[model samples]
Structures are given as C-alpha cells and as structure tokens.
Target: MSLAVNPRFIPPAASTFVFDPDLVAEGRRESVPRYGDPIWSVLALTQNPSAPDDCIRWHWFSGTFRETFRFAAWTLVNHPLADQELARHGIAMRAKLSAGRIMRTVHQWSIFAAWLDERGITRLADLDTEGLADFAFYLAKTRGLSRNTASGHLTGLSRLHYYGRSFLPPSDRLVEPPWVAEGMDDYLPAASPLGGENSTEPITPATMGPLLVWALRFVEDYAEDILAAHDERRRLLNAADAADGPLLPDSGDALEAFLEGLEAEGLPVPVAARRGNPLAGAGIYLAAVTGTPRSKVRQVMRKPHWRTYTAQNHGPCHLGTPVNATLDAEPWHEPFTFDGIDKMVRHLATACFIVLSYLTGMRSGEILGLASGCCPDPEGPPAEAGRHLIYGRVFKIATDEYGNHDSAGVVREAPWVAVPQVVTSVRVLERLGGDGLLFAAEVHDKRQPERRSGRSLQLSTLNERIERFIEWVNTHAENRERESEMIPQDTHGRIGAGRFRRTLAWHIARRPGGLVALAVQYGHMRTLVSEGYGSRSRGGIHDLLDFETARSVAEHLSEVHEAIQDGEGISGPAARRLIHSAAQEHHRFGGIITSVRQARSLLADPNLNVFENKDTFLFCNYDRAKALCHPGRSGKYEAPSLDRCKLNCANIARTDTHARQLREAADSLVRQASSGLAPEPLADRMQERAQGLSELADQHDRKRVLAGMEGHL
Candidate 1:
C-alpha cells in the first residue's frame, strides 16, 4: 500500500497529488514510488528544499531511460538479461551523455532488445558467435544505416557486451573485434564517403547586415519599453494585493465579513504577491535569443523562484490584470505555461535574449548558466587586467569519474573572459535572477512528456526562436520604413550559428575598424582560466577555437588574393575581365584582411565561383588549375602552395563573409568614437580606422557602381 500526499496552494483550494511516498529503511519516509512512477522526476524534485519528500506523491515522472520508456510502458521482456544490472548502466551513461543523447541511445537499444526477444534469444548466454554476425548484418540491411552509422551502433553494442563480459560464460561472451575471420569485411555495409569540413558562415552585410543593425537598435532603444511595461504590471499586482483581501473564496459568512472588515476599516492586507523584479529574468531572454542548451535555460529559470504556477479551480476570476491572462492560462487539468504577470515578464525576456545573443558570441548554454553576480568583479586582483570575467557553471566540459555534473546540475569552476556587451547582459540578468539562479519558473518540464508542465526549454525551442528573432528583425525594419536596414538570409534561408561566431572571430583577429565593437572584448581566456575553469573546461577552449578557425580562413583568402595580383591566371569571363581591369591600377591589399574585405565585395559579381581545392585546402575556382582539381584534369600534375602559385591555377576564389565583418568593425569604431567614450588616443585611432574602412567600402562600391553602368555606360 502507498500513501499519497497532496500539495495545497496558499489559498486553500483542492490539493494536488504531487509526491507519492514509499516507506523504506527505518521509520524515515522517502518519496520512492513503485514500478509506475517517473523515478527521475522524483529523484530530481527530492532534491528540492521545500518539496515534501517524506510523504508526497511526486507530480512528475522522470526516471532513467529504461524506467521512463520500455520498462515503464509495460513492455516486459521476461528474459534473465532484462532483469540484470543494465538498468544501472543506463543511469551511469546519462552522466556522460546529454539528456538528448541518452534518449536516442535508449530508443535504439530498446528496438534491438525487442528484436532479440522475438528471436528467442532471451539470455546473452544462449546467443552464439554466428548470432552476433547475423545481428550485425541484419542491423545494416534492415535499418538501412550508412557504414559509419552502423559502425557506431556496433561500437555501442561492443561496450555493452564488454560490461557484462565478466558475468557471462566465456562461450556466451561477445569477443573484442567481433569478427576475427579475415576477409569478412564484405558482409557489413560500406562506409560512406568522408565529407570535408563544414565551415560556419559569418554574418555579412550582403547576408544579414540590416537584420543585425535592427536587432542592435532594438536592444539599445526598444527593449526598455517592454521592461518598463512588465515592471509597471508587477507594481500594479502588488498594489492590488495590498488593496484587496487575500481572496473572495467561498468561506463561511463569518470569515468573509471578518476579511471584509479589514478592507472596510482600511486596515493592512493579509497576504502579499510574489516579490522580485521580472527584469532579473533577462538571462532566460538571453538563452532564448542566443542559443543555449534547453537544460541550462531551465536551470536559470528554476532558480530564485519556480516560474510555473497553477490555479486550482477556484477564484471569482475577475482580477483586472493585463489582458494577456485574465484567468488561469491553463486549466487545472492542463500543465502550466506562464500567464498573468508572467506573460509581460516573458515578453521582456524574449526581447532581451534576442538582442543580447546577437551582440555577444556567448554560447546559449553559457548565457543560461549565468548567475546574478557573475561578471567584471571590481575588487578582483589588479593583476587580472585586460580581461573581463564572467562566473558561471559550464555543464559540458568538466565531467567527473562517473561523467556526471559536479553539484546540483552545475559543472562549475571557471570564469569566462567576457566582452562588455556580455557583461552588460550579465548585469541585466543579475537584476532578474538576483544573487541566485538566472532562469526559473515556467521552464519546460520534461518529466511529463504528455504535458508542457515543469520542464526546461528544449534546445529545439531556443534555435527555433533564433530563427523567429531573425524574421522579427526583417518585419520590424519594414514596419519602421527602414528597408535599407533589412537583413537578408543566405540561399538556404535563415541565419546560421557557426558562421556568426566565425565572423566575430574574423573581425577580432583582423582588428578592423568596422568590427571594433568586439575588440575591447577580446582577451586570452587562459590568463584567468587557470584560476577557475582548469584546462578541462570546453567553453573557454571552444571560444578560442572559433577565433583560430577564422584566422586560418582569412590567411588562406589573403594568399589567394595576393596570388591573383601576382598575375595568376583567372577562370570565367567575368573573373578574367576583373583581373585585366585591376592590373591597370597598382593596388595591393591584405595582412589586416578586414581593412579591405576584398572577398565580400568581389562576391557581389555574378560570374564568380568559390570552390575549395581539397588537395591544396585552398579555395580556387579559376577552373584553369586542372592539375589541382580532384578529377577531369587534362594537364600535368604539379604541387601548389600559397608561396608558389602558378598563373595556371584555377582554384582561386573567396567568401564575402569576412569582408562584411570588416565593414561592421569600421561602423562600430565610428559609433564608439561618436559616443565620446573612447580615450583621445583611441578616438584618433578610431577616426583613422574609420577612414581606411570607408576607402575600402568605396573601392568595393565603385566596382558595384561600374557594374550597374555596364553596357549603358
């Protein structure tokens, strides 16, 4: 028999059967449920301080992979192996793998298990080597998996078999390198062609120039309007609580009259509304805008206070709050989503997220993990000059022996050297999350997949909103009659994440005036990282990697541009003409690639193709470098390098992404100087940088102008 504990709201409505407890080990009661409960949710909420762990029916069910799915769903495979310690393995793996990874792996294995049971292979001891070989063949042919993908499955199986190898009989155990027989490679699916690297595109003027401009302005000017409205709403709700009695619930007449007497006699109110400014939730907004993992977003939301609230089928329902939520946004039967003050609060959060993410290259997860008091410590050691720091838990990198988070879902120990824009965002979120967590309440609840209740916002949602934020910028620009500020998408449609980071890095590495906004933000994370986030932290390392990748791309493009000036042969009619015209003018540009951004401007022309020479790792589309081409080459083979490029090489081209970054840098410097915040020396430097950038922009513009005048001129 089980005892049920119901959670009652402060207003004394019907109780919710939230935590169901089971008596185990001594008289001390634990909320451990039997076979049917979501054990993970119970385990998770069990950690909650305020939760009634001893005697309550936990509302959510979030057990391990096996508990939540195959086993819980009542698909009992009555086999000896199924009853063994593999369930423990699932939880152990969850420590290393993300929740998303855990789900996918569990699903895959569950399918394999069901297939095994159907084949009368209930126990591992009963299966032989022939069965293993047959299963591998079946997995490839039946699942239609590519060679690499099938290999991954086989790897997973190998690990599991290795785990149970000690307990199983020697004959029953699957051997290492499953097929020792030589020349049996033909039985498995062939591996797919190894695809080359996928470079993340940088945001460019030709790509999302206008969109970025509008987004920046929105962050600067319009975001406050929403925040102001939300604050005012909170103030009004507090005032209402002060004016009115706790509730008009149908209590006895004597109780009602006694309560009415307080209002009639002008006495103080009984209960107050929830406290804390909603602007503190800006971290949630940042996570949504920037692209944080769904897990971190929920952590931020849950802190400080639970965001999800539910109305228990009571109240007269005529509270004059915002029209966004006049009643319970969700019925008692439905899982909760934010309503009332939350609607206004979340609106501001959304705005903050969209604006902050575009301005700062902080990862979505990093932004979400941010706490209230985590940046630019004024009283830090003076030796830490030249670097701005952000203190927060980084979840992905520093795994323990069990591959689990260090504490309460936090994998902390380092400070990220942040930009001022990121610092400002942190400050804003500090106000929202206070000295506690950054995100809380109304987070997506994963325990009950059936309902959208207490959960963290999934990664998919954050990315989707990122796409939505882009569309919003375009729509808002059109609405404001600022068509020139319109941000456009690539042919693939939608702005990409990888290129955005690369673009920022390119500007920083190039040190161009147009991209100077991020200049003050750059620092060697290693300088401060040693004290906190040891070398193991992946967040700091990843940021550095982005910077390096952009630098490499810039150097390659510059080398190719220099080659063209050295009278390298050109491909295509337009490219040949461009070379001939450029030969007349003694112009040489590169080194600080952002100063010129030649690739961006030249890319506007229609008759150019940027193709990568996989052999040389250089972009060459002259199509004349037949020897460098992978196939269809008629000429003799000759080695090519950036130092010694022949005029016959056809594989020379560039991307406009870097050029646009340079343009932005110059614009930023101009803006900074105009604000009069920069020092005199810096101001002078800004003007000089701006002038050089304008000359480069003009050079590119001249080509465009002359192109427009083609034939007619």
Candidate 2:
C-alpha cells in the first residue's frame, strides 16, 4: 500500500505502485503499467473504461529525444524516479486533471529533463533556486515562449516539487517549489497588451455568404444525384463480392447485349475518367454494369468481338443517371458517373459539414461527434412542428455526474437547436452509411480497415477538405461562366472549422437583417438561439457576441464622429445631443477603442444615444421617455426595437445618408407603382406611399443643422 519504498529495492521492470490497487485488481493483468514499459497504457486504471487507448496511453520519451539530445536526457525522462513522480501526480489529482492534462504534464517533464541534462545536472537534489531561475530564463529568452506559455512550463516543474516528496527519495526531491519566493510571473516576460484578445478571426460576410449558398446547393439540390451514385457504387461492390465463383456460362453474351443496348440507345459505353487503355476501362465499367467481377470482365474482354467494341468507344463516357438540380436555369453538373462517384460522395459529406457547422453554430468537434440518429425526425405532432435538435457529446469542459473530468466526455443535456437545413444535412449524412460518428475517418476510405479506429475526421484533414471543396466550387462556377457567384477568398486565410461559430456570432450580433434571416429562414427565436449556443460552457459564443456588439457600437460612433467632422448635417430631437456626445467621446478616447472594456464603457454612456438601424432609413437617438418602439418596458438596459420604427417618432435621426436612402426608397416605390402588373387601387396606394417618403426626405433636408450649431439648436 505504501508507495514510498526506495527505488533501488525494485527492479526496473517491476510493476509501479501508482495505480489504485483495487482497480488494478479488477482490470485485466496485461493492462497494468510496469516501470520499464516503453509505453504505459493506463486507461485501465481510470474509471472511464471505454476511453480510447491513445487518450490514456503514456509513451516514454524516446525517438526525438534520443535523436536530438544526449542519451542522459532521454534516460532522465525514462528513469524510474521520473515515472514514479508523474504517476503519483496523475493518480492523486485524477479528478482535476484529465487524461489529456496528464499527457501535457509528461511533455513538460520531458522538456525540463532535457534542460537538466544539458546543464549536466544528473540529480534533482543538485538543483537549487538559482538553477530553477536559469531554467525559467532559458524558457523565456531561449525558447521565446510567451508569458502564459512559460508559466505553463514552470507550473509543471513546480508540481514535480510538490508531488515528488511522496514518491521520490529525499535525495532526489527538490528542496523547494520552483518560483516559491517571487512567483512565476516575475521571472517571465511582461504580458503583451493584446495578450487576452480573442485571436480567432471571424470569416468575413462576403466569404461566408457564397460558401453557405453553395453548401445549400449541394445539400438541397445536388444531394440526390451524389447519393444515387453512392448507392450504385455500393450495389456494384456488393454484387462483385457475392460473385466469387467462376463467370456464368452466358456472361460474355450478357456483356455483349448490354453494349448493344448502349449502342441502340446512342449512349456511349461508361469508362473511368483517367483510364488510358480501352480494354482496361471496359473491364472496369462493364463489370459494374453487368454485375460481374472485374477479373471476370477482364477475362471476357479478351474475346475478339469485345476488343472491337472497346476500340470504337475508347474515350471517357458520362453515362450515369442525370440529376435534376440546376444552376442559372441549366443542369448544375453532368450525370454522376461511376468513376467519380466516390469523389462526389466525399464532397457531399463535406457540404453537409459546412451546412451543419455554419447553420447550427456547433463546434467542429461537436458536429463530427454526431452519430447517425443524433437528429432523427420527431415522432409526435407537437414535436414534429417544434424545433429540431441535435444530440451529441461535448468533450471540452465536460464532466461526469460526480464532478470528475470525464475523458470519455458527457452527453450534452441541452441539445443544439438545428434549423431545417441542418436537419437535412444530418439526414444526408445518415444516408451516406457510416456507423458511430457521422464524420468517421473511414467514411471516405474503407481500404485501410486496419486503420479504422472509429474516430472522427481530424481537424487538419477537415481543413484540407474544406480547401478542396472551395476549389471545386470555384472551378464549377468558372465552367458555368458565373464568375460573380464564386466564393471570394477570405482575407483571414483558409476557412478552418473554428471560424464558423465565431462568424455566426458576429453576424447575429452585428447584422440586424442576419437576425431576421435566422428567424424567418431557420425558424429560430433570438432568445432560444443564443441559449442553444451559450449552453456549452467552453463555447464562448455569447462572449463573442458581446465583443462583436461592442465593436459594432464603437465603429458606429467612430463613423458618426467622422461624419460630423466632415460638416455633415443631422436632424432629429436628439441630433444635437448625439453630435455633442459623439464629439466628446471621440476626444476622450482619441477615436480609437482598443479593448472590449473600453468598447463596453463607450456603449454605457447614456448621452451617446446613437443606435444603428441600418435596415431602416434612420438612426434611433433613443430616449426612453420619448421612445415609441417599446412603450412600457423598464430595465437596467434597453434597446430600441428598430423593426417597429414609427415614422413620426421623436427619437428618429436622419443625416445626409439616411435622406439619400429615403429618396431611393421613394424611387423604388414609384417604379413598383408604374410596373403595370398591380391592381389600380394597389398602384394608387403605392404612389401615395412614394409621395410620403419623398416628403419625409424633403423635410429632413429643410430642418437639418450643420456641425457647430448645437448651441442655437
């Protein structure tokens, strides 16, 4: 029971006393860790018996350590003392530290060991406060690590001193914790001013808009053709598998008849895209068409009649079922041939990923973690008409009922609210035919069955796939001469999985039309939409929303300040107050808000009542007493209901830009009235509306005040 026994007493290969003996007793004997084991598979020691082996396994430092550094450093990490200390630390704080955290600790220990070996300090007892200080300096100055990252390295070393007392002998244990006197902060570089800013850039609207449009085209329009080709390929493979015996007596005749049928219908013989030799292409395609094995088809192709037929039709053929989806009133793509079916299916899956990730605002991992039935069709009438939900496990910040870090992750109690598009994407993924994860690694390739670990597609691989999807879409658009519809290259670089949720939050927070689109198109209530996204503790979509909202407000204020400086005029009850406050804040902040806190403080100023209402033709310089948008609502903070703006509201503000937009609206109404398609009464109403909008614009031009006239106003 005592783990404090001298290390010299036990052989190197002996089992370590790190695991809970009671749990080890119940587990298979082979799963136990030995001191000399090069890689320790330790999931058996944890309560999560079903966790993946890679998640729990600890590989002792070997390959790169041995190749790059001295053998002594490699031995230092592989040493029995190092093993005991880390094992003790892992077991003692298993509740707080996850399997991934334990792995990170081991990595930090290896780095520390390498630093010790370089300095020829063979034993921990030889290390003192001065040596620890040198190591801290090495990490910051030599390694060029950021303050936070250096602190992480120092934290691991400090834990060694804390945990080593119980596991290491007195001579091997450190005399004191690392940075005990001055704290780790003193030894590290000063934190950067932009250190805590969220570095993940949201995808710009130009890029995301076209990307989602094409993804919808794939999911809603072209899915049937891709999936049909997928089904046909699967059926052919199944038939080939079942026909293991020798070829049928009439197999050659059947293939001949099929070729004749193709000729009679004036359809070209189906051939693989890149296959050069006619006989080879014929063998492959005829086998698929005739439900015969490729080997059997090759044998039959040796006949003189078939050789003549293939010679006449040597080029690649597009002879599959044509899909009904169209682009610009024409077919979007050619018929789905067998040669490119696999590629189309992979693209279809990627399209589903894009739709699901962009629309639902689910993290990449959560989307990939989805199973076949995660978003099944609702059963009851009430549920059928209700919101669709996707049920999946969340790994980040996931915990078991006992409040322990669960490496296996926990099923999310509140599922992600899915729009109709997301629901369709899930259904398409289900039809693609993968078990367990919807985006399983083996879904695209089944040749390497040995490598099938039932894990979801990796983030790096998915990123590459996204790039390919973009290239394919651009190519397709170019071929159709629709250059205007191509997805623009994002200035932020490649569109990775992490960008989707951030971009969704940015759109929801900054774009009022975006909110209405989500409500009308996606059937989402604003409250439930935010709640669904913010339910995951680690998602931070709500924080992103807050930051984006604040940033938008700051930008709005900056624009107003610039407009006023340019001698623009404004008219409204609150216009004079708005101009004065904007001028004051601009002077106070130098018109540059650098941080979220500064932005939030700017938004809190009651005198700066400039609220953006871009969808409408005016800004709301809101005063609750004169507000007509929300009459009876009272709270610590309130927002103007821009959707219900009244024409005569006192809070309405109009600058030159708003007046121009009003004139444009009037022109549009006049054009609609003269279109000749409307009834006489409706046309008259439209003309009246146009006249009213024109009068409003004329009134704004008459009463608008120039800058520096606030005192007279």
Candidate 3:
C-alpha cells in the first residue's frame, strides 16, 4: 500500500535499512550513555572544526567536543560571546546537542569553545586543518596551556577529523589536520606531546592553596554547619577581641569568660567556642591543661564542682560540678590501645620514646629532646646512682646535616613536669643502655647515592632496635601469661608509635581505678594546689599535701604492684568512703582506689571522671602519711630500699613490730611441738605422739641457729 521513493545515499557503514529521520530524532532524546560506557563511543561525531567548506558528513564529527562545550558555557556566562566567532558557534552547537552533562571532566573543550566564540566561525565546514593548528598554538603559547595538555586536545581533534572524513567520498576535499595528512607521517611524532606517561600533572603546594581555600569555603557553606548559625558566632566574634596574644597561654581568662557566657546561655562549648583560633586553641589547650580527651570536655561541666573537673581525666579527683547530661548523653568510640606495638618497625629511641610516651603521655618533640642526666639515682653506688631521681623535662632540639657541623644539633631546656612512672621508666632505659639519638633521628647515609638518605638508629649499627624490642615483647607475651595482659590483641596488623601516647591517655581517662591510679592521685593533688587550696580551705589547712608529690608516690606504688588484691572483704564503695574520709581528715592524701565495683561504675558513667569528688574515694589507694601497703595486705609488705627501690618510700611501714610478733609466734609453736605438750581435745585416746611435730621444732631450731651464725660462725 506504500510507495517507495529513492532514499538519500547512505554511507557503506550505515545500516542496510535507511534510518528514519523520525527514529533518529527520537533516538537523540535518549540519554547519551556515560563517557565511560562503550555505547557513547558508537555515537557519530557531531562537530569537527577542521572540515572543509561544503563537507556535510565532515560537519558531523566533533573534536574536543565535550570539554569545549563546558568551556564555552563557562565563557558565555562569565565572558561575553561575540556573534560569528568560532567559539560561539561551537558553544551554540553544543547547547543544541549535549545540554550540559558532557562538560564535567572535559576542561579543554571549553577553551576551544571560547576560541570559536572569539573567532566568529559558525560552522565546522568553514574551518581547515591550518585553522585548527592555529587554535592549538593559541591554547599553548597565548592561553598558558601546558604543552602536554595542548597535545591531548590536539589528539581528540585529529581523531574527529579522521572519522569525519570517512563519511565523505574520496573526491570530497575535506582537508585534514596537519598531523593526519597522508604522506606527511614523518612530520607527525609517534605520540602526541601529552601522550607519554611523563606528561601527567603533579599537584604542588603552590596550586594547593587555591584548592584548599575553595574546599574550605565549600565545607563552610555546605557540608559542615560550623558557620551556619549566626547568633552564636556573633557572640564569639564579640569575645574574640578579648582573646589575643600567644596561640595557647596558661591563663585562659578571656577564653574562660567566653566559654562561661556560652555555658550560661545553655549552648555546647564546641558549638559556642567555634569562632576563631583562640576558640580552637581553647579546645586543644583545655585538653593539654586538663589532660582530658578533646571529646570529653562537654561532660566535664555537669559535675557538682565544675571547676575541679580538671582533675577528673587528668587524675581521679572529683571536679566540683556535676558533669552535665549533655556530655553523658553522647557516645564515643573506644579509645586506641597499645597491645600490638611490639610488631612495629621503629627506632630504639623511637621505641623508648614510645614507651616513655605510653608511660608519660608526652609530646613527640618533647620526648626527643630528653637529657641524658634527667633521671639520676640519688642513693645508688656512685657509678650507678643516676637511679635516685625520677624527674625530667622535655625540650625542642634542632639537627643539621650540612657543613655547619659545629652547630649541627642543639638542645633546649624545656619545662620540668614530673611524672613518677616516666621518671622511673626513663631511668630504667638509661641504666640498661647507651644512646646516640634519644629518639629516632632521620639520617643521611654517605653510601650509594640512591640509598643515601634514610632514617636509622645510631644506637644500633644497623636496623631499628625498637623492632627487635617489640618483637621480643610480642613473642614473650605470646608465650607467657603475665606479659599477655599488657599486650593488646590486634586483629588488625602492625602498631604505630603515636598509639602508645594515645593509649596512655585513654587508660588514664578510662581505667582510673587500675592502670591510672597514680595519675589520678597526682592530678587530684596538683589541681587542689593549683586551685589555691589555702585560700579555699574551710579550716585554714595550710599544710595541704602537694597534689603532684602525692601523685608521684602513688604512681610509684602502682608500678610496683599491677593490681589491687581481690577478696579483701572491703567493697569498692566502702573502700572509697573510707579513703575519702581519710583524705578529708588528713588533708595530705592523694591516691586512687582500685576496686572492681568502683572501676565498673567509673566506666559506665563518663561523668564520674568529668567532675570533682565523683571518683575521690573510688581511685584513692596509698596513704602518704603512713607506710604504703600492697592492696589487701596479701603478704608482708617489704620496705623499699633507697639503693634498689624507685618509689617514694619516705613513709614505709616499720618492720620491727611485725618482725618481733612473728619471731615470738614461731618460738611458741616450736616449744609446744618439741615438748609433746600440743593439746588434742578431739579424742580422749592418745596414740604415741608422732615425731613429725617434734622434727618441725628441730628444723625451727636449726633455722634460728643459722640466723644467729652471722659474722663469725
């Protein structure tokens, strides 16, 4: 019923059945597949700029099309587009075809579109290979395009030219780009200027500033709501005028005022203190000054004595205020642990630094500059007496590798802050060692040039001795039960040096009753003194115990004994009450109580350590006024000798009374057994008294005889 008219001549590559104009038009409505999809490649090139005049098929293929399209759009919106310009024509064509999605990654395409808009060339048929080459030169020499990137644009253009002409007959003079001209192969290099792998662009610091600014702006405007609410920020801006000077200063009076204002207004500190550097520094400084996690500051305010919260995480003393419901309301991830550090490849100094860090929570740079004579033993043998002291400072040092060897390395004296455990641990490392770099220092080897610059431990001739130490610890822990407890189990592989310091902080914050007893003790004492106890004391208690000193003594006790004894008949709560009452009466007590019940309560309530007196009695242990006893009096407590013990043993239990009592008991038992006067009230019948009890009396006699056989047998 239909009559067929001769169709227009279709290329051989075209399907046998002529494509219906309606169908082709409808097909264009379908989404162009993503550039990454193979189907996008099948679409006919739609706009080649290098085609000769009157070449219809050549007009279809487009080179540098997508990138140019976006460029054209951007240029049109930002820069005026002129009629008859080649860039304008290209841009207009792109707007009709791709809409906009193709422009995302295609940066170079816009340059060409701008070129066309400026040149007044409306059609691809109007341009020739020479014209395209002129544009390429414009992009490179004039537009400041890198030579390699310009070459990439050239490659895409050439591909379009080749494919565009394929749609035309041989006689059609659709001139090709210079690079693709036949019999001129020698003129074209094997690869485009940007084709090689070496042409890849690298990000430099110079370029990063703009990106960083843009990203920061984007984050501020969109992702993070830090700058969203203006009322709170206005308050901070008003306060910022007051907070000038050093980045972080000891007295945060102005900062405290700002924070207090925010708290008074019932806003979160993080939310209220979010204005500028001083505010940021407030969060960080509070962490260092108070020794709590940056994440826990909110919880500190709710305590009954808010001012005393500084001692909560720093040690176990109660802060005056109740830690607010807000802080307790939030859940935080469990802090990092250091169970697998022995597997890390680190320098001995670095490892020692790691240990020092875990034991002391010192900053990395601070730990590095520790002096050799820091921990001197006051009472040991003259040659071995660096063991008497357990205190030091950490400083900053600079090292140079150049001709100025005279001033190559310099050390500075830092503020001296004493931590009993740190002092003891450092002394242990020193007494057992020799050192080059106290912490790992990056070194340059004068050996093979390529391998010349690397880091090494000077103490060991080759390799990091820390690795060996960690491996030994790991292996020993795996084989021994006692060591296993100290080592953290790592389902994930390897350990980092930073984790040690963090873990130390975590345990102090989380395990105040067990591992952090000493830290808790000292932190409490320091807080009390620093808070001006004399001024605040109700009874004019001038002989207040120095929190730091008391803490140090407690720390020494904890190091000597890992755990408080169980089955002590005293409940954790009861123990806390007893200790708190004692501390109140003595006015010189500072120690942590490590009872299981108290520890559980501490963990369950984050506010426990965030406020004063929350854990006052809970973490207290040692008696600064009397001799230190092992928890539970499990065994006879031994007096630590000045030459051997590193603890503050000034007030140890006197052994005279206990020794006399034990000697008398032994004599009484010996006499009763030896004289056959031991009473057996259970039975009236008497078997001949066994000599076993009599033999025990003889053994006791022999031991007594041996004990008195001193100096001259």
- TM-score per candidate, in order? 0.49, 0.78, 0.23
Candidate 1 structure quality by residue, lDDT tens digits, 1-713: 43322122111111321223331222223333344443322322222111111211223222222322323111111112232334633322321333333334444555555566668665544666667777778878987877756665565554445433433334334444354333236546975533211234455536545544444444444344434444554554454334333322332233334334544665432221235433333332223232443334344345442232111111111223223221124211112212233433443344455444444445555555555576656565778655566666555454556554332335445555554545555555555544554542233122323222222334445555557666666675577666765666765455543344444444433332123332232223222223333354255433433333334434544554555645343332234333333332213323232222243333322223232333122244334344343344545322222333332354443223223444777898899998988898999999898777666445444333232233331
lDDT of 3 by residue, 124-194 (tens): 55677778767766766676655445555665454334323433223322246675443223223243333
Query: Comparing candidate 1 with candidate 2, which one achieves the higher TM-score?
Result: 2
Estimate the TM-score for candidate 1.
Answer: 0.49
Candidate 3 lDDT score at position 362: 46
CA shift at 107, candidate 1, in angstroms?
Answer: 1.5
Choose the strongest candidate by lDDT: 2
Worst 10 residues of 2 by lDDT: 67-76
- Which 10 residues in a row give candidate 1 its minimum summed lDDT? 309-318
Clashing pairs in 2: none
- Candidate 1 at 270: error in angstroms? 28
**CA shift of 541, model 2, Å:** 2.5
Off by over 4 Å in 1: 1-34, 37-101, 114-127, 130-152, 163-208, 242-348, 354-361, 380-387, 401-414, 441-456, 490-503, 506-513, 516-538, 541-713
